[model samples]
Target: MRNLLVLGLALLLAGPASATEAEAWQALREGRAVLLLRHATAPGTGDPANFQLGDCRTQRNLNQAGREQAQRWGQLLRRQGIEHPRLLSSRWCRAQDTASAMGLGAVEPAPVLDSFFVQPRQGAERTRQLIEQINAQPRGVPLVLVSHQVNITALTGIFPASGEGLVLALPLSQPARVLGRIAPP
Candidate 1:
């Protein structure tokens, strides 16, 4: 059974490594890579038991430090001259608020990008769907996903703290590969 599981995991990672990663500022300047970011720093870890999908007030939210980090990251992006890039977020409140604080304009909720903390039922399927979405996006305009640590880690094997971001190059017809990371600047 363990062998079978290991094989399965191996196959999962074998997907085409086609993304080109770059530093946050560099990616913004390049204007092409997709940004997979763990939501801005929150006070605690994962959402609380009472956390509700619809109400952010009920959840452990971004503290001043987290909010400031998000804002600074956004400013960095803007300074790089990327006025607008497609922004998507996990439905979690922390993720949503993180995107908002970045001053990046309206953020679309993507359930597929939700955290896999509680044993996400269809992890592989969800990741594949998100990858397809990223690939389908038009070239030149950056794609950004504000989500949770688990989600980002599961997808890229790169564990990130809140406010950390990964720039990925996903060219249509090619596979997506990890390029580089966007650490707090």
Candidate 2:
């Protein structure tokens, strides 16, 4: 499609700083990075007024394109030799669906990855909790966390597009550093 081509061109034009895409993938494969990905395209900014976490109908579920995009991301990871990373997702339906579509192993619900759109004050708290969780993760184990835009921004200071991911180097003693981003073609 024209849109996908345009997106690919844009990503190629706006490539990651210093580190190339290959290096980013290598870092991920080596388990030296953590991937924080925004949920795939849901065709809306936020959930509806009567949103309920238990029901997918009440939430903004992913469209066909979104589902395909998630599958492609999974394939990309596999191609990069990251077959079965520790997958975590927010409790929201959209996030859950995106994680499942990744074809990765079982997805564990992480409250720390929950969106703070309605309640802004929780963003910082949840971000801190997520950082602590990342720091505690066992070394040499890759991690992929699927969350909302707000949560991702709160954690990494990067606003990624739908299905886009930011690779971070999370050191145990120091703060997490953004290494680069991965936008599948």
lDDT winner: 2
User: What lDDT tens digits, residue by residue, belong to model 2 across residues 162-185?
Assistant: 999988876622335777787743
Model 2 stretches with alpha carbons more than 4 Å out: 1-19, 172-175
Per-prediction TM-score: 0.78, 0.85
What's the number of clashes in each of the models? Answer: 10, 0
lDDT for each residue of candidate 1 in 1-185, tens digit (9 for 90 to 100): 99999998887776433233225346645655677888887887767788778988778788888889989878977886766877889998888888888897889989988877766766667777877776676677766789887777667877887798877766522234667776865
Question: What lDDT score goes with residue 169 in model 1?
Answer: 60
Question: lDDT (CA) for every model shown?
Answer: 0.75, 0.83
Question: Once all C-alphas are superposed, what RMSD does model 1 give against the true structure?
Answer: 11.3
Give the clash count for model 2.
Answer: 0
Question: In model 2, which residue pairs have backbone atoms overlapping below 3 Å?
Answer: none
Distance from true location, Cα of 46 in model 1, Å = 1.8
